[model samples]
Target: MDGSKVALVLATSAGGVGRHVRSVADGLRERGAKVVVLGPASADELFGFTESGARFVPVEIADRPHPLGDVRAVARIRRLTRDADVVHAHGLRAGGLAALARLRTAPAPLRLGPAAPPLVVTLHNASIAGGLTGAAYATLERVVARGAAEVLAVSPDLEERMRALGARSVGLALVPAPATPPSPDLAPSHEPESSQDARPSQGTAAPSRAAAVPPEDHAAAKRIRAELGAGDAPLILTVARLADQKGLPTLLDAAAGWARLDPPALVVIAGDGPLEAGLRDRIAEENLPVRLLGHRTDVPALLAAADVAVLPSIWEGQPLIVQEVLRAGRPLVATRVGGVPVMVGDAALLVPPGDAGELERAVRRVLEDRALADRLASAAVERASRLPTEDDAVDQLLSVYDRVMRTVF
Candidate 1:
């Protein structure tokens, strides 16, 4: 009811994190709460946090661990959040550092005396690394679990991990995708079942029809298919970064099997990252029927052009692209990991993560049966209709803040 200041902190964010922070910042300011976003200057440049009416303070929170730089970052975080009623940090790196700052720094000349403001941390991803890197991240997880007043996870697995690590308050984070704009041609066909009920069926195809698309979209799809060298071949599209976490290797392995199919299916990947060079080399050496498109902007058109949409990620936490695929009303074949099953419901073909055979078979199943593909496309549109919006994310976050303040402050 009274004036209270909140500090939202994060590390490097090229995509989802930045957009989410900006959206949350806008929502908080609209509710009359004083909001300040503290992160890298580059993140501000990319995401435009200040444009959302929140004061943007440039704090260098690097992606990896560095001794001297981390000290400097902690000092900055301490100085910036000294007057804050609550501090909320996103991602493991930022959360660990925020926890360290509050633990080390003395109480400042602000609202609370002798004790720093309560800290809240949100975990958006899981530890997919191994050996030294995995251990380091695990250490950070424990630091966050013990230091934070409240912790939020974007998936069930993350939530369970945080609780096991002894976090006082661990709840699911509300990281919702924006609802897709409705099409006049599409209507509510049937309610999709939960992930438990949804399974990739090998049964005979059910009678179904493709979703209605505009002539222009179909034309654009045709153009893209031509560009990807899918003359008369069935086009299979995957939109992901060329990184290990994205499971690009598995995708290539699956593509190897597709070469034997009649007319030979074409695999087109649209994204760029560090693993590009090696991936290209392997593709050339193996003569796989796959093309690396390297980050295309016309994703909707690509989705339209495709026989099927695919995501072969090793792990993900409510990926925006999967939601985008659903919005486009495309039949998806994705790995079952993180929040993917929860997101897709019965809308898409979900397979085990990093299983190339399963991934290949799923794509094959979709391509072989036009009726089953149409059913998935119909369920996708239905799923897109039920996804939460930016407003829902803000409302959920506000409740978390309120509870943490009342319980800890």
Candidate 2:
């Protein structure tokens, strides 16, 4: 109830945690909370939290499990938590570290501080994707449940998964990452040029379907189309990594069949992975008009530049690009996975994951129906308007801090 600032402590190996952490940190700052972020060296550099005018503490809890690195990270976090008003861990490593730091040496014979910060863990995703580290995954979940005062989930699926993983009495919250609207609405600049040249070779190999569109990327599409000599045709994009879980193979086959039709639809995939060489080889063998664009930073610009945004992930925990593309107010054709349906709502055309036929038809439908495109764009614009503003998110976070602080005082 009194006036006091809280500190936000976030950790992540990589990926979306950075996004969530940044949003939280910015929110906290807006609410007058001092934030301290801990993460891998790469994250510290890439995210540039310090440049964003927040304090950043480096914690090298690598994406992969390493016994020594994990132990060291926990110790570093323990030190940081001493002065924290609230310790909220964003991902598994940070959560486990917070949990371990708060572990009782024996049955708690006594209480410690008059105002110990409440420890909260936001379950970002199921670490079942951890493979052989499956046991480690279970252990991490247990530690977070035991150590943290609350568990916050980003989606309903993850919240249910948290319960199944032994998180009892969870404070279920469907806190999807906030989306920012485009700066200066970029309408279609010119009559979209014929995209025939941007089409990839039917026989070209593709990377994983989990590949992502490049950031600030728009020029490459025109370049690819010009190279392929098919710039007049309609171009569709799917942004994700080329991993098996992303359903790249199914999309590729669908593109092959779609190519045999009139008006010639082209699919461009932007991302990188171990599947790159294999995907390219498969494209060559099967002859599909799919192009692979390695990791791009200009994704927002590309979202503005493209005719449509497509997401085809087999399994996902709320992909950020889908939210971003929607915020750009573009029509989207996405597989029904993760929080995509939640983000797109009625704004996007949905297709089943890994269904090439469905994906192909959806893309074709988007191309043929100008009225449908306008409708989706209007709906997307409306949906984007409903997303949590940074100020609102900050206010909610401050409320969480007050709630957490009340327990301590």
Candidate 3:
């Protein structure tokens, strides 16, 4: 792979995809592969691929569907892939653009040879949007599937979706969590001191983000917890982008029911999105005991400060936050969606998606039953042991690249 050139294309650099791309690029570089990244300009600011030793090229790729932007992105991708040995695209939009670019830039029929590069697309989400938007996305998925030489899904559920979308060569590759170590200062106090020692070491816990938290940031978390009146109260933490896909509405409804209990639990949601205004309105109208912290960087501290972590997403592809929570040794309550069940296994209390009553009951059970929460936490540490580290994920991905190159060229 020393002389091989791999181009990674991404649509948005704002969420988990951006992080994943950065990790892959770093891994490829470590393996002596030339790597180039093409994505929205914001990706540089968000993930800093250039600073991390990848050739970063900005392109006009929007997160949502746009005919004009897609055309521009595809044209740019074609130019970038001129010297690339492998064009690996992440997410649906980027995959579509890369596929179209490959088609437009293919060598003439008479000149076509085994040296032609392969296009590998990794589908991060299997969810289809509702109404007309869903139909449009479905159409794009079909185009991407038909064009890509290989389609990789982050979860088994998404692998099935890829196959259904006409992908002839489909594979599964679970997204790996970052390897930032948990902050020692932010470690939760409820777990026995021997908890970490009790678990068998599997070396699967991903390295966390930089462990050094500013003193002020730690203070801020403490102040926020205090403001929420979380004194001896079971604190529930949810870190997700506020969107329809996140199932915030359902979580709010469950919160409302939980609020009516004799001693309501305090909930803190740490992330912002387009649904912020509407979610705030609903929170005020319902008077739920939930706080929204927009886009936090100190999630490790927050996890250490919370009693339980919950993910109520309607759909997901191996959510990183879920893995983070488990790595922090916190009990989890997540909906059975996408690869969540596979990620959590028996470590979390799984509930049906969009079920407010069941969600509320699960949260309540965790809060009231100390023994149950302890059991889940213990299981969480062990479950986290099974997760692949960033290095492992990179190794698997490079193997895929090799396989695709072999099959195509």
lDDT of 3 by residue, 102-125 (tens): 663433312332344688999888
**Alpha-carbon TM-score of each model against the true structure:** 0.88, 0.80, 0.88
Candidate 3: segments with Cα more than 4 A from true spot: 105-116, 181-224
Comparing 1 with 3 on lDDT, the higher-scoring candidate is 1
Error of 3 at 103 (Å): 1.0
lDDT of 1 by residue, 1-409 (tens): 1367889999987677777788788888887789999999999999888765679999998877777888898888988998898899999999988988886542331233345778999898887889987888898898888888899988889988999988898988877654445432233324533322222222333112235243435445545766766766777889887877899999999999888777688899989988999999999999999889988767777777777889999899888888888878888999889989999999999999889999999998887887788889989999988888888888887887888778753
Better of 2 and 3 by lDDT: 3
Each prediction's whole-model lDDT (CA): 0.80, 0.66, 0.78
Q: Quick one: best lDDT, which candidate? A: 1
lDDT score of residue 253 within candidate 3: 84
In candidate 3, which residue pairs get closer than 3 Å at backbone N, Cα or C atoms, i.e. clash?
179-206, 179-207, 179-208, 180-207, 180-208, 180-209, 181-208
**Model 1 clashing residue pairs (backbone):** 271-295
lDDT comparing candidate 3 with the true structure = 0.78
Q: For candidate 3, what is the TM-score?
A: 0.88
